[model samples]
Target: MRFIFSVLFFALMTFSLSAQGFNNGVSGEKTFTFFDKAGRNQATFFSTTPLEDINGTANGIDGTVSFDVTNIAKTIKGHVKVEVNSMQTGIDLRDSHLKSPNWLDAETHPEIRFELTGMKDVKSEADNKISGTATGNFTLHGVTKEISVPVTFIYLKESEDTKKRAPGDLLGVNSKFNVKLSDYGVQNDIIGNKVAENIEVTFNVVGTVK
Candidate 1:
């Protein structure tokens, strides 16, 4: 009994010291900006597009993020989930129409997702950033297509005087991710088949290893 207890106690202590404790991760609320009125007047048009706050889970945005200080190139693979129903363009009538069977078909396709496919090391005049491409299957209007989004990863480390664990060798993904409505068989409206093609999407993600 004594030997068993001693061995178990040592193992637990080693795990507690070497393993990372409950990590208080960072989260962000993203905004969607659109060039309105024929790409002339650009404005943020979202009714409630903020992410539901990433949690520590396999499927969560922050969950799959792995970080490495010496070799960030080795740290690859992350996940993110976007709620389709949460899209808002600041117009109740338009939002409702979008929810219909025309644009997104929210009832059928509820999520827009991305999976990392490649990574590259990049140096800035001031900071370190990682640029890469992500391949994702976006299902819209009952149609799913394989699409690639240009992405950039920028990492910001914490200052020494800070209180909590800072994000070091932070990964920054810069991408020019875009898609079209008609390409996915979705129309602007039930009557108008003309969809403002070329939807430009961008993301700046920072992930920390727990």
Candidate 2:
């Protein structure tokens, strides 16, 4: 009886700490921000350039991301997977155009992936916005590129949509990363694609706690 009580106590304590630093072991949806060419109109350009995918949480960043401060490193690494077909722009035509051979070519390679390399928490020089520089290898269109994106991570608690109830829940880190289409060899391949040379990709991801 005493041993069982001790086990319960330890479990409760671990959960409490996990809840406090949800960003550490918790996973959240990833949001991406694709940019447009320097010369383009954005008024009719609704954010249809949207995709739906989530990472495996801190594991998306690294296998061992402890909440403790001293153990923290200059960077955390993780893997992210995105379903290229789940993109929605509120406009079927635009979405289809994007998914067609002109842009994403989703039929051939239906997923976009990234592996986190390093993170630099700093304030941006352009807007003074506090951001972290997460450098990683992004594989798109069956091509991989090493890119650095500035992300602002805000950690939050689990949603009510959980099918299984747990004593504690996951951690959600809401973040956005932007990129240009031309940089990744998408523009030339896209036929008559009025799609801007700059394409913004975002992630709304959720990661399960370990």
lDDT of 1: 0.44
125-206, model 2: which lDDT tens digit per residue? Answer: 2211224566788888878999887664443334565324221333233455556666766753322334444544544333
- List RMSD in Å for every model shown: 14.3, 13.4
User: How well is each residue in 1-210 modelled by candidate 1, as lDDT tens digits?
Assistant: 999999999998754422221112333322112112222211122111232211111111222444443333334445554456665554467566766766677788776555444344322222344344445565556666776665554545455632143333233344555567677776544223233455555443344333
Q: What is the TM-score of each predicted model, taking all chains together?
A: 0.54, 0.54
Error in Å for residue 134 of model 1: 3.4
* Model 1 TM-score (2 dp): 0.54
